[model samples]
Every structure is written in C-alpha cells, then in structure tokens.
Target chain A: MYSTTYHRPATVDEAVALFAKGSDAKYLAGGHTLLPVMKQRLAAPSDVIDIARIPTLIGIEASSETLTIKAATTYFDILSSADVKRTIPAIAHLTSVLGDPAVRYRGTIGGSVATNDPTADYPAAVLALNATVKTNRREIPADAFFQGLFTTALENDEIITAIAFPIPEKAGYAKMRNPASRFALTAVFVAKLKSGEIRVTATGASQDGVMRVPVIEQALAANWSAAALEGITISEEGLMADIHGTSDYRANLIKVMAQRAVAAAG
Target chain B: MANVQLTVNGKAVSADVEDRTLLVQLLRDHLGLTGTHVGCDTSQCGACIVHIDGRAVKSCTTLVGQVDGANITTIEGISKGDELHPMQAAFRDNHGLQCGYCTPGMIMSAIDIVNRYGADLDEDTVRHELEGNICRCTGYHNIVKSVLDAASRMKLSIAAE
Candidate 1:
C-alpha cells in the first residue's frame, strides 16, 4: 500500500475541512473497499479522511413510512437493528447474507453504494425500493444515483450522509453468489409498494450496473405470483458476460431469480 | 507516520507506524504476534481474523490507524498461560487440523460464531457461518465437530460460572 496521510476527525465539519485541504482525498468509511484497492496499488490518494469514527454518520432510524440509514453504518448494524427488521425485513435479510461475518463487521452500506460495484447486494435493494441517496450537497433518487459499473453521481467532495428507503408493503431478495468471493453472480430484489406499484431490480447480471426489469415489474404488478413471470424472457442485450456465466445465462438467471424473489416475498 | 495506541492481549501497546500499515503487519512485525497468518492478502482468506472492539474483522485489510484506542484480541489472547481455550482443546481432541496453517483464524472465527449462535448451533449453521474461514485439511468434518464440541463445552463452562 502507498503511504497516505490519515485524518481521524470526530465531526463532519472537521472531516470536510480536512478533505478540502487535500489535493486528492477519499473518505475512509469502513475501508473494506478502499483499503483493498490501496493494497493492490490500484489507488493512491494523498489523504484519507476517516469518516467511520464520526458520530453523526453511524446509525439507523426508522419512521412509520421510511427507514433512514446513515451511510457509515456497517452491515452488522443493519442486521442487528430491530427497527430495520420491523420496517424493511428484506434489507435486514440482505444485510445478513452480505459477505461473511468478518466482512459484515467492517463493510459499510455507504461505501458499498458509493463504490457502486455491480455485484454488491445493497444497490439492488436500494434501487428496487426507490431509496433516496442523501449527500452533503443534494439528494439523488435511486433511479438517478447509480450510473454504471463502479460509477455513481457523487462528486469528489460530496459525502453521502444517509439513505432514506420508503418502506414497501412487501419485498424479497435472492442471489446466486460466487462460490469463492461471495459476490452476486446474478441477484434480484422484488418490492411491492403501498401504492400498488411493483419494482424489480437485478444486479451482477447487468452491464450497466443495477437495473430495473420493467417486464418483470409489469407482470408482477398485474399478478403478484411467481408464475406471472413464466415465459417472460429477459433480453440478453446489455447483460454482463463472464467466465461465471454468459449473457444468455444471466438473462435466464434474471428470470429465475425474479421468480424466486417473488416466491420468497410471498 | 501515525502514532497508534491500543490494548493487545490485555496489555496496552503503542506504536508509530506508517499510515498504510495494516493491523496484521503491526501485530506480526512490531509486536511479534506471529500466530496470526496472512493467507490471501486480498482479504478473502480469514487467516488474519481478529477481534477489534469485540467483533471479528480481517486485520490484514484494516489500517493500524483505524484501530487506534481499540481493544484487539489475536489468537495468542484466546487462551490463558498454560490452559488452552476450550476451542483450542476441542480442536486438539477432535483432530481438527492437519497442516495447521489456517488453525488460528479458524479458532478465532469459531469462538465468534459460538458467541453469536451459542451452544445450540446446528451443523448447517456452522458450515454457513464458517464460509469466511477456509480449511483445506480435514475436509471441514473434524473442524465442524470441533466447533460444535467447543460450543457445548463453552456453554457448560458458562453455566458452571
């Protein structure tokens, strides 16, 4: 790893001031992604502002209709949160299945969403549930937050504060994880909102990162059943193809995973 | 350089390390706690698993600066001076290891699993939770038995306390 200046600030204002002074700086939230990348020398930032210790960036709050999770909150926090489980059980389940026990202890939802890894589990949940990404500058809807693989609408200095997810009537997540890395090979999240609208999002299979499956959403909106997705083939276009699976195979997985997610929701 | 102070194995230790120095490096190199191995440095292998503030985390991926003022427990701290921890005793009794390369990480992770799930753990839960620790030897049969036996023994010890 490259030698970098480390700043541990107790408050957001201090962290922002430290960041503003650096030529190239990155917020160190949990450091699961950033540290690994730094280890490989893939990134060499001049400064690393440790936002993990900031008190304001670490918690989960649930209202009657929405779940607000601070960006720096770890997966372990979400898994153990009674409010999260009561308000959005699917997110709790997703957090439980993310990575392993060690990773869950340190990996933060904000870092995962900021990095926007296509195989990450949180993006599928965020996008399908129509969560709002709140940053220091502005709020970006889930639909507009994730741009593509390893990309987001976040500016260099804009730090994500929290994400607000509207509690759905019901939701479920299913993933076929890579045996070694535990990243999703193909995963889907199905959510049915109180407004009688359904949203389906697939991760790991999309070339453009987490994306909605309008066809599956349409089918489920019409009839909320696993059988409603039968014979509904996802187009192979713009789907990821790799050693693990072909584009056609991912398309097939999208259909199967959506069905399984619907069944799990039921 | 960054000055970090933390408690290790019930003793307070301080070090001046580079910002990029991993916790594993600080423990293994500076403190001479070589029991923690570094297999697959990319954080996939659980060889460097240690408890920071009572939670299992990969020390290899954690910057030493991040753990400032935190209490850390490595494999060396699991047992008392002469008596082995129950998990260690169970591994010995059940022949849970062959080469013993991954034993430290496996033991650390097992203690954490039992801490969370308690003695009533099933085989499937053990297998699922042990996903982070990889054991090439014993095909995980003896390792699984070891964890279960350790869990039961630990629970009995807790009850006796």
Candidate 2:
C-alpha cells in the first residue's frame, strides 16, 4: 500500500475537515474494502481519516415505525441485535450470511453501503426495505443512493451517518452465495409494506447493480405467493454472466430466488 | 509514521509504524511475535486471524492505525507456560493439521467460534463458522472434529470451574 497520513478524528466535523485538507482522502471505516484495494494498488489515498470510532456513528435505534442503524455498526452487532432480529429478522438474517465470522466482526454497514459493490448484500436489503441513507449533509433515499456498481450518491467528503429502515409488514431474503467469496451470486429481497405495496430487488445478478424487479413485484401484487411466479421469467439481457453462472441462468435464478424470498416472508 | 499502542497478549506494547502497516506486520515483525502468520494478504485465507478486543478479526487486512488502543491476542497467547489451550490440545489430539501452516489461525478462529456458539455447536454450524479460515490440508474433517472436541472440553472445564 502506498504511504498515507492517518487521522483519528473524534467527530464527524473533524473528519470532514481532515478530508477537505488532504488530497485524494478516504474515510476509513472497517477497512475491509479500502485496505485490500490499497494493497493491490487499486486505490492510493493521500490521507485516511478513521471514522470507525466516531461516537455518533456506532449504534442501532428502533422506533415504532423505523429501525435506524448507525453507519459504523458492525455486521456482528447487527446480527446479534435483539431489536433487529425482532423487528426485521430478514435484515438480521442477511447480516448473518454476509462474509465470514472474522470479517463480520470488523466490517461496518456504512462501509458496505458506501462501497455499493454490486455483489454486496446490503444494497438488496436497503432497496427492498426502502431505507434512507443519512449522511452528514443530507438524507439520500435508497432509490437515489446506489447509482451503479462501486458508485453511490455520496460525495467524496460526505460521510454516511446512519441508515433508517422502515419497518415493513413482512420481509424476507434469499441468496445463492458464490461459495468462495460468499458474496451473493444471485440474491433477492422481498418486502410487503403495511399498505400492501410489494417491493422486490435483486443483487449480484444485474449488470447495472441492484435493480427492482417489476415483473416479479407485479406478479406478487396480483397474488402474494410463490405460485404466482410459476411461469414468470426475467430477461437474460443486462444480467451478469461470468464463470460463476450464465446470464440465462441468473435470470432463471432470480425468479426462483424471488419465489423463495416470498415464501420466506410468508 | 503512526504511534500505535496496543495491549497484546496481556502486555502493553507500543510501536512506531507506517500508516499503511498491517496489524500482522506489527505482531510478526515489530514485536517479534511470529505465531501469527500471513498466508494470504488479501484476507481470503484465515492465516492472519487474531482476537482484537475478544473478537476474531483478520490481522492482515487490519491497519495498525485502525486498532491503535485495542487489546489484541495472538496464537502465542492462548496457552499457559507449557500446557496448551483446550482448543490447541483438541487440534493435536484430533490431528487437525497438516503442514501446520494454517494451525495458528485455525485455532484462533476455533476458539472464537466456541466463544460465540458456545458448547452446544453442531457440525454444520462449525463448518459454516469456519468459512473465513481455509485449510488446504486435512480436508477440514479433523479440524471440524477438533473444534467439536474442544467445545466439549471447554464445556467440561467450565463445568469444573
């Protein structure tokens, strides 16, 4: 890794100031993604501002209508959270399947959401749950948060503070892991709100990153059951096809995963 | 350079390392504690697993600056003077290792698995929890057996206490 200046700031304002002073600065959260990329010479930031210890960014708050998770909260904490498990067990279950035990202890929710890796698990949850990304400056809706793979609505200096997930009537997640990296090969999250609106999102299978599946959502809206998706199929176009699986296979898998997710939600 | 102060293996140690220095480098190089190995720098293989603040983490991917004042425990710290930790003894008795390159990490990770899942762990749970630590040898059968055996031993020792 290239040599860089490290700053451990106490507050978000201090962290923002440090970022403004340095050229090509990066906020260091869990360092799971940043450190590995830096080691491979993919990212060389002149300054790394450690925001993992910021007191304001480490917690989980559940209200009557929403469950707000601080950005710096680790996956382990999320999985172990009684409130998260009780309120949205699907989110907790999603956290359990993310990475391994060692990685879960260190990796943070903010880091994962900000990195916005297409194969990441959080995006599917965020999009399906209609969560809001609260940053130091503004709140970005989930629909506007993830723009593309490794791309988000966050500015360079903007640090995510927390993500507020609205409590849904019912929700569930199902994914096919890559086996090696354990990242979602083709994952789907199904959520039904109190008002009877259904939201379906799939990650790791789309070429454009996490995307809402209208056809499956429409099918589920008509009849909320796995049987509703009997003959439904997602087009192979714009889906990821690599050594892991072909585009057609992913398209077929999406329907199957959506059905499973719906069944889980039930 | 970054000034890192850590409580490692129950001893307070301070080091002046670069901002990019990994925790494994600090343990293996600066402190001369070579038990923590770095089999894969990319964080794939769990050769660099260590307990930071009672939780198992990949020391290779962790920057020294990130865990400045944290308490750390390496493979060298798990035992008494001569007696082995129950998990380590279980590995030996079960012949859980071959080539021994991944032993330190596997043991560290195994202890953590017991810590979280407790004495009532199943085979599938053990195999799932061992996802981060990769052992090319032993096919992980003995390693799984070792972890199960250690869990039982740990339970027995806890009961004795």
Best by DockQ: 2
Give the per-residue lDDT of model 1 (tens digit) for A1-266.
88899889888888889999999999999898899999999999999999986788889999899999999999988999999989998899888778988999999999999999999999999999999999988999999999999999999888899999999999999999887788999999999988878999999999889999999999998999999999798999999999999999999999999999999899
For candidate 2, give the DockQ.
Answer: 0.89
Best by lDDT: 2
Q: List the pairs of residues colliding in candidate 2.
A: none
**Candidate 2 — which residues are off by over 4 angstroms?**
none
Please give the fraction of native interface contacts (Cα pairs under 8 Å between A and B) kept by each candidate.
0.78, 0.90
**Candidate 2 per-residue C-alpha lDDT over A144-197 given as tens digits, one digit per residue, 9 for 90 to 100:** 999987999999899999999999999999999987788999999999987788
The lowest-lDDT stretch of 10 consecutive residues in candidate 1 chain A is: A92-101
What lDDT would candidate 1 get against the real structure? 0.92
Positional deviation of A62 in candidate 1, in angstroms? 1.3
Q: Give the per-residue lDDT of model 1 (tens digit) for B16-98.
A: 99988999999999999999999888878798999998888899989988999999999999898999999999999999999
